[model samples]
Target: MPTAQATTTTNITSTAIDQKTVPTTKDGLPTILNHWDCRSSQHPTPVIMIHGTFSRQLSQIDVTQMLHDRGYCVFGIDAGHNDNLYTLIKPEYYGTAHVDETTDQVNAFIEKVKRKTGAKKVDLIGHSQGGLIIRNRITRYGGKDVRIAMMLAGTHQGTTLMGASKIVEEAMPHLFPIIAAPL
Candidate 1:
C-alpha cells in the first residue's frame, strides 16, 4: 500500500514504482507537457511546476519523475531566464519582471489545464522564486482553487542577490542597458 500525505488541496502518496521516465520540452530540457493519464491514475490534481530564478523547466527532472511515478500529471514553466545572476538582473523576453508574469501565466495555465482535464484543482511545486511567485499569486490574486503547494528552498523573504541587483540598477544606469541585453 502507498503511504498517504493529505493536505487541504490534494492527497499525495508514495506508491510502488511501475515505470519512470524523463519528460522533455521541444528545447530538449526535462519538461512536463502532459498529465500522467496512465491506467494506474491515482492523484486527481495536476502538478503545476515552477523553477527557481535563472533556472529552466528542464531543471525539474527528479520532480517530474517522482510525480509521474505517483500517477500525477506534471507541467513546467520555463520562467524565461537562465540561472545566472547576470541573466536574472538583465532583460530577456520578460525583463526582470518575469517572476510575476510567470506566476500569473502559471495560474492561468493551471485553470486552463483543469478545465481541459476535468480535474478539480492543481498542486504547485516551486523552488526558490518559483515558490515566492506562487505565494504572491495565491495571496494577492486569490488562488483559492489551488489544491496543494510545496516549496523547496523557497525564498519567503527577499534574496540578497536581488538586493545587490537593486544597488546595481541604481549605481549603473548606463551599464543597465548592456546588462539587460542577454537576459
Candidate 2:
C-alpha cells in the first residue's frame, strides 16, 4: 500500500515506497498508477517519454523526474508489451510488441495523458524502437495532440535487426518467428 506524496516538486503526485517515488494510473500493468492531477499545474503542456528496445517505462524515469523537477508535467507508459513465452518468464518484458501494436499503445497513452493533464497538446520524446513507434503512431494515425517530437537513436530509416531479419529470412524461415517477436 504505497501512499501518494509529492516530493520537492509542485503538482507531482507520486507513491512513496522505499524512498522511491513513482506515479501510476490505477489498476496498473500497461498504464502507470500515478494519481497525480495536473489540472491546475503551472505547465499546461505535458511531455510524454517513450523508452526503447526491450525497455520499460523505467528507462525514461530519469527524464520524467527531470521534467517534473523543472515544473513540467510528464508521463510515461509501458508500451510495446506482448504476450508470449518471454513475458511468461519475465512479467516486466516490454517493448516486445510489433510496430503496429506499439503505435496503438502509444496512441492510447497519449489520449490518457491529454485527459489527465487536461492539455491540448503534448511533446513526444522517444528512444530506439520507441522513436519508430512514435513515427508509426503519427503517420498511421494523425498525431492530433502531438506538439513536438524528439527521437533519440531514432530507427525511422531502419533497424539494426534488418540484417538479422534478412539473415534469418534466408537461413531458417521457420525460426523467423523467434527473432521476429521483438524489435
Q: Best-fitting candidate, measured by TM-score?
A: 2
Output the lDDT of residue 52, model 1: 76
Candidate 2 ranges beyond 4 A from true positions:
1-36, 39-42, 161-183
Pick the lDDT winner: 2
Report the poorest 10 consecutive residues by lDDT, candidate 2: 27-36
**lDDT tens digits, residues 84-164, model 1?**
556546433121345667677767777776777777768889888778888977986686778888898888785656676
- Give per-residue CA lDDT, model 2, range 16-82, as digits (tens): 3321345444523223323347543576677788887667776566556666666776677777777
lDDT of 2 at 121: 90
